[model samples]
Target: MAVIDLSKLPFPDNDLEKFLDSVCETHELDFAAYAGMNPVTQTVHGFVNYPQEWQTHYVNQNYVNRDPTLLLAKRSIAPVDWQRLRQEPSFDMVFSDAHDFGISDQGLTIPVRGPFGDIGLFSVTRKCSAHDWALLKAKILGDLQQAAVHLHDHVIQSEALSSVLGPPALSAREIEILQWTAAGKSQQDTADILSISHRTIEVHLRSAREKLGALTTAQAIGRAISRGLIYPA
Candidate 1:
């Protein structure tokens, strides 16, 4: 389905819930969710259709810190298959508790990176034979990747910070400078190419990083590309 359909929904929360429901029905899965954590505030937001009891228990127990799936989200940008995660003794409790709560042992999590240093995970869970799930994941992986991107975009737009403080927009020159940097140009090189002084290049690059809320030039470049604010040369 086109992600634009989400915009037609009456409310952001309603849109996400309906999307999760559609995913469950379309894939014959037991549950679906889109979850994210704020990097600075350490707050979690969930658009999930799981049992309220399970959700409550998870938070009450601070399961997010120990959840193997969410822990993997920190280091991976690819889709994760629950079966493929390392089966360590320490992580066993997470999976065991999930199964007891009716969450399937077989699931997929698509890690999504947003421009503003936020990460989102789009997950689908189902109880199925290992063979059946492998085939299902093969079929839906590509579609879910695209869906994850759109879902994260919608979430970012609906965030309270976006409605209030908003993300800073880089100027054209700032974007151009970062694009050149991403293309492997040094500050001096980009300055020469753009007929500007090295100090001016440094200023623009710093401004771009600050605007993007990035700690480094490389991070600023990455943020710009992720947000479609700039393209690689």
Candidate 2:
């Protein structure tokens, strides 16, 4: 088997409309939009850098709270198809919101949840023939979900998820060792807390340092604390 490189791959890291642009290239959609948000805060937080007028109008009117598509997506974990929503009278207000903002009535949104506390939506908007939109929606939903998931994971890790979760690192065993170490546990005590042996605890600690890329046990302790892997007393 080929070995996988542990080094980080360089991604765009931040580009608005990356997901939408990607889907547009492959699909018939004319506009691609993205929104990275804090679900708990009920704020858009960030979007794919749309026009200033669009942003200002969206915020000034508080459309998200009134957006039927967002409400449907949140209530259901699965991808909520726009065509399905359009037929529901409860969501007819969505059309009003779109019209108010001068947005196309045709669009699909995919919401993605990820580790380290990340959530976002990827959407494709089009003002095109009905047949074109049907084909575009069919071809693009799966890709939009994948892209949204990727961007969510990227945001959670890079954007200081200390507000929620953080740094998807280590394992339960590593955390047990680190906690004991922080409590001034001897290797013997660490092993005792974990019902293992001192040598085993040492192995766990060494593995944790390597896994956390910490040069010292103290550094490991600090890193774990900051990442919410271990709570401070």
Candidate 3:
């Protein structure tokens, strides 16, 4: 199976079309789309590599609210295969029009949960037989999941989105402690370096974890780095 090193991809800015195009080409997919919901604002932002005509038609018809793929994927922890949604009426309603644009219903949608309450859905489609689609999905599913997380992080960290949803607030002491921890220093070492009591370090670390919505100090460091709040040691 092919492994995609999504970390090497450029971080997305306002335009995600190029990023989606690269994902499709790398994964041998026909089309790629991303939809992310900001829990704070309850607004959905999307990007797609589909034809412009279809894009316009989807919006004109107000399909965003009724698309089964998006609805089902949003509620699923695992990737939602188009096969599973084929029996739904909304599936036909959306894909019947999609077919007119030379698109196929052979697709998969992966959902990524952010540390915050945000959610991102990454969908890819291909025109292929059921057997071929199954094999393709099996081979690329892991990479697609990685891509989903990468895309979600970059999207939520984008300047446009950050402007609306402010980045996690970490105080100076909290950041200092996290930096030391990321540098492989023990809590005692960090306390000694800062000339503070070990209990103070613990308090700051706990606060940092809560602010980043991280379950552990290590996860907090990773989330901090991904959000450009701290650098990797």
Compose the digit string of candidate 2's lDDT tens values, residues 1-233: 11111112234534434544665777766666655566444445445434557656766666666666665665556676677687667567556655676667777778776542445666667788888777866776765665666555554445444425544468888898898888888788777767887888887887787555454799889888987889874
**Ordered list by lDDT, greatest first:** 3, 1, 2
Candidate 3 lDDT score relative to the true structure? 0.82
Predictions in order: lDDT: 0.75, 0.64, 0.82
Tell me the tens digit of each residue's lDDT in model 1 across 1-233: 01122333357234677777887887778997777766755666667788888877877777776777777755787888877675755457877787788777778789988777888888888888989888988888876776676667666666667546576678889988988898999888899999999999988887687666564788788889999998976
Clashing pairs in 2: none
Q: Which candidate, 1 or 2, has the higher lDDT?
A: 1
Clashes of each: 0, 0, 0
Residue lDDT tens for model 3, 1-233: 12122334465433457768888999889999888887777777777888989988988788888898888888999999988998999999999999999999889899888767888889999998889898998999987886777677667776365646664579999989998898999999999999999999998998787667564788889988998777888
Write the number of the candidate with greater TM-score, choosing between 2 and 3: 3
Instruction: Give stretches of model 3 more than 4 Å off.
Output: 1-15, 159-233
